[model samples]
Target: MTSHNTFHKVVVLGGGYAGTLAANRLRTRDDVAVTLVNPRPEFVERIRLHQFAARTGDATINYRTLLGKGIELVVDSATRIDANTRTVRLASGRALEYDYVIYAVGSTGEPPASVPGAVEHAVSIAEFESARRLRARLDALPLDAPVTVVGGGLTGIETAAELVERGRAVTLVCGRALAPTFSASGRRYIATWLSRHGVSVLRPAAVSEVRQDAVVLADGGVRPSALTVWTAGFGVPDLAAASGLRTDALGRLLTDETLTSVDDDRIVAAGDAAAPSGQPLRMSGYAAGPLGARAADTVVSRIAGTEPAVIDLAFTGACVSLGRRAGIRQLARKDDTAVNLYIGGRMGAAIKEVTCRFVVAKRIRREADKPGSMSWPKGGPRPAGTVSPAETASSAGEVASP
Candidate 1:
């Protein structure tokens, strides 16, 4: 039998906020060998994807800078996880064994399959490569091009505002009131900021179909657009479900409050891919990093023959970036209920910018330097009635499209 002090191997799938943090925090254990698997060589900061799509920022972080010295970086995609064999099969024909696995592939643009013609016509700013494609497409378009942004979430808001700030004729189609998750005051600030940036807002307007050059509204109204960017919602990878792991409807790996897999004790989940207590955790980097750390702690505790504690995640608020120069900060309670408090205009924009920077760079770097240095807001237990944005999109795999 392997002794408790025997060297243990851990493989982290996905190099996003959660996966990276999980791997970094695992460095503290000298007996654990950590290997991170990712498709790209550079870490794409999904949070700043809109800034990159707008040509206002660079979001690529080289693995050399973000990954710690003890973690080995493998450039590949995981196609299958064989829990029976305790191995992961890669697209590159490599098989990796692990004492524990962290599934944190995060999310990507909602597949264009949600709407007719969307796959063929609409563009997006959901990931690094997708944002690059959008940037290039925008660069080729004329300055006066009419652009339509779908969805009222933060991504939609930031994308429309960024384009409008660049002098593009922008319109946002919100199926409901803008920023539905935000407080009324927060929503007002965002609406006003977009208006000031010359972005036309369409509310209570539903899009029935996306065309080659426009979107068809549910009311049978057709709006012409030179380019349509779909920011509707996001969908996570289906690896967990495919691997026969217990997952929520959206394929998010199901875990107990301790972040341990319900089916396999050797497996855990974090970030956008984790569904703890049958509830999908918050999608933001703020929640993802801490969840990853918690997963690491759980696995470490198990290896050390100790009882692991349950997850304690709290949401402080949501920061909506209107553009490079404007934003809205919505304060919230522990359960993610928006309060009546908000900050807007340039001040909000600055705060949002700093927060993004810290999430993408500063915080992870600090944690890499000093393992376990990171901390997250842990309010009361997650309220039963409150559903996170991720859970709202959860379905029999028909999740929201980004």
Candidate 2:
């Protein structure tokens, strides 16, 4: 056991928005040593992944410019966390001992296996490597090739627009409606924008099977698709459950209001991988930064022998980019329900671009340069009532921001 005078060794899992900021924020305590573990050598701007896939923008930045001095970067994947032993087992067989562990593995797009041929034929835009493979595939196909985007969420809309701008013939096969998370007005705006931009918008349609070169709808109609992009559902890594820790239905670490794990106070959670109070905020970069900082604060408080603060972050809004020159920003209540107000067209596009850049360049990088300097809006109304862990696990899937 570490003595009171010994420095606290903190190991942060996943170098996404939450994990990166949490690692930097831990620097606020001189007695803490921060080590960030990630599977990649670079920080991926997940928000700009659609642009990256379309070759419209770059999405990766070398970690040298994003991580703070004295912070160790472990280029390895965490296979499991042995909480009882206070050790993290890596895929490479190396084990890391830590005084406290921060779980922030982020989220991913997982196509449902029930749909035949989806896993083999369709590509996902939820991650860096996946986007890279998508780009390569798009490069190999002719611009006029028929491309189908499945899912009507923000990610699907953004991907469809990006591909259209690259001169590809695009069809958006939305399961229910376009921009389902946005306000009614926002959805109307997206539908009109996409329709006017030469995109064939198919709504309230379900894909029964994803074939090699076509998608068979539930009604038995087939749509020709040279390439299929799946952005339907988002899911977290099973690391928490795999490690014998309690997790929500989505596999997010179960945490208290303070972001401390319900199963172990020595372990905290942040980002998309954390389900605080069993009612997690929508998995978005807008929420991830604040959650990261808060998770670090809990760790710092424990080391200082003080009471840790609970989560109080608020959701201001959600934004979706349409191609490179147009977009829409949907305002929302503190509780995340969309309001009537919104900004569309070129101005919306500019703000969307700025918000994406600020997340990494300013919010994350600044925290790395100046620890504990990041902050977010608070005073949002706390969600009332609670659901059983089993109930939460069976709830509907949550999609991260595009």
Candidate 3:
């Protein structure tokens, strides 16, 4: 490692999970100067957005309390990146130079633009402002009004469950099967649990159009609702594309195994904005945090004249809340393969709560400790030629049998 005075400057953009962890890790290092740039002064606990929509008031985190001593937190969005000069242009008309940069801008929910009147009428619970808007709408709606939650993904399911617990009439509309990514057993567990909680599930039905008071289905059926929530999909911000970096069709930066931008190594992408080299994982906090931590370690290793290590996908699971006291825990292998392990009821809820608390505590610890000063474990790029299970599976599929 370089001497404290000789270490270079590092700038981390986006103070979400990935950016916050990156800044915290780098601040621990006495040699490197760290700066965190984000549009909001506070960190939004994005995973708890559903709770906020249910009027739980759980989406805010104080950056001042989370940032370490040497790390500078800049409340502004990064608008431009000059890879050639290693400079980042902020939306606030400030330019910062850095030896390394970590991009963790996260993502935004896709507005209900496809369905007419949905964008103007439906509520989204993705961002802090959106959740607040939804909460206000819920408070003003009639007690017996029907609410339709579009999409059956994790976000949609969680939102629907939370609303149901609030004594609201909820209808979950899924175009296909619910929790399609889960194992067969997990899918059954979730469907049964949701059905038992007074949530009506509509499957194999596509929303032809969304009106102010009802949604028209493909089969010429209409579902009445006073409040509609659209959680169908998410769209990453166009910052990378706007800054002239390479991005995939969905606007996610194409990243290699090391989480480095395919177009520019000086700029690394993480969190929801990064697409894995071969096997692209779903955009979730479970994956984003590790990717962010790995990206930070990669930048540090490069500066320390050591080769960057490849990421090891060890912990991959899905924990969904059915309500305040019930949840479903679906386990998965390192290769992103789902297993038939389901945890539900009160015990599952406790597990889910603990998991969320662990994430928060982990961030707190990282911020308190900082980066380079701590002695991190050492391992090679590929773990002595033994590829990760995900990599091995992909390689085997690519080989031609004799």
Highest TM-score model number: 2
Model 2 clashing residue pairs (backbone):
249-393
Residue 210 shift from truth in candidate 2, angstroms: 0.6
* By TM-score: ranked, best first: 2, 1, 3
| Candidate 1 per-residue C-alpha lDDT over 203-280 given as tens digits, one digit per residue, 9 for 90 to 100 | 999788888778899999999988889888777889988898767776788776777777788897888888776766
Ranking of all candidate structures by their lDDT, best first: 2, 1, 3
Off by over 4 Å in 2: 1-5, 383-397
lDDT of each: 0.82, 0.89, 0.77
Evaluated against the true structure, the overall lDDT of model 1 is 0.82
List candidate 3 stretches off by more than 4 Å. Answer: 1-7, 370-402
TM values, all candidates:
0.93, 0.95, 0.89
Tens digits of per-residue lDDT, candidate 2, 253-285, equal: 887778888778899999998887777888889
In TM-score terms, candidate 1 sits at 0.93
Tens digit per residue, CA lDDT, model 3, 143-254: 7799999888888899999999888999999988898778899889889988988899999777777778998888999999888898888888888888887666677776
Which one wins by lDDT: 2 or 3? 2
